[model samples]
Target: MMHVLYWSGRAGSLAPLCLLIECGVPHETVQVDTSRHAHKTADYLRDVHPLGTVPALRLPDGQVILESGAMVLHLAELAPSLAPAAGSADRAMFLNWVAYGAGSLYPAYQRVYHTDHIVPDEAARPAAREAAVVALDRCWDVVEAALEAGRPGLFGDRPGAADVYLAMLALWHPAPERLAAACPKVRAMKDAVWALPSMRQALAVHGLETA
Candidate 1:
């Protein structure tokens, strides 16, 4: 059995947890409450994840996999319908957008959430957050355009791991209402992913069911 380390609220673990539910794969969810700094504990760092992050996957063989994006891709392998086949024409596109979400958008949000850490000067922290928000809007524009071109989801017409990944990121936007207004297509895509029963269950677990 696989074990997913997670926490309540909108964390990166939401996507993989949703996929695990969608795939109907047996797994256990272990909450690492960040509010209490459980993730930074010595035991977690030594046994679960050296980086001390949630969304770490403990495979059946006891090896742990970190990084939510990597978990999404790996979980998709267990349920092929969630992603394009390994060498299919859509495979490249799928990988491209997933990387974009993980590499680009994820970091952009981190900049906003951790502006004080990124900007040493107290006076510059707000500016850093504003810049991050701008970058996030630009990222959404790219996704919105792609969705407008009739690609309902990153993996084709149906909501898949990539779609779930993007949706989770979308919720992290500083201004979700403004984001939805500016990127209607992205909103639609998020709605599509949210419509999935498994996704709803996962989101509810994360206390984001109304989001």
Candidate 2:
């Protein structure tokens, strides 16, 4: 069976977990409690994730896949319903938004959550977080416009991995209500994803069922 190394409440793990459930694949979840520094352990770092992070996928063959975006894509391959058909018209748009969520939005949230890592100076950390928030808002603006124009889902009428990925990131916003108010389309997408049984199961495990 495959294994997903997870840390509850960590946003990075949300999309992959949801996809795994959506795919109905045989998988196990191994919690690497950040509060106990389990993710920083040498064994976990060497074997599970070189970066010592949660949401790494240990395939049945023992090949570990890091990066949640990669995990989502890989899992989607196992169950194509989670994504647009490869080379289809919507495929490019699907890939684009998935990359945007993983590359642009994820990093922006990391900047806000780990500002000290970027700005070493204590006095500058707050400013760094503020800047990250602005950048995050801009990223959301792009998503909002896309959602408003696109189908109910990020790429189609069906909620796919890209929609799940975006919803996972949206929940991490520093001020979710403010973001929702500013981007109703984004909110609608999130609400749609949230209603999925697979997503509800994943969210319950991550303690985000009420989110």
- For residue 189, give model 2's deviation from the true position in Å: 0.4
Whole-model alpha-carbon lDDT for candidate 1: 0.85
lDDT of each: 0.85, 0.83
Tens-place lDDT digits, model 1, residues 95-168: 98899999999998888898888888999888878988898899899998877545567657889888999998
Cα TM-score per model: 0.95, 0.94
| lDDT of predicted model 2 | 0.83
Question: For model 2, how does the per-residue alpha-carbon lDDT over 98-198 read when each residue is reduced to its tens digit?
Answer: 88988999888889998988888999888888999999999999999887644557766778998988888888899999999999999888888888899
Look at candidate 2 and give me any clashing residue pairs: none
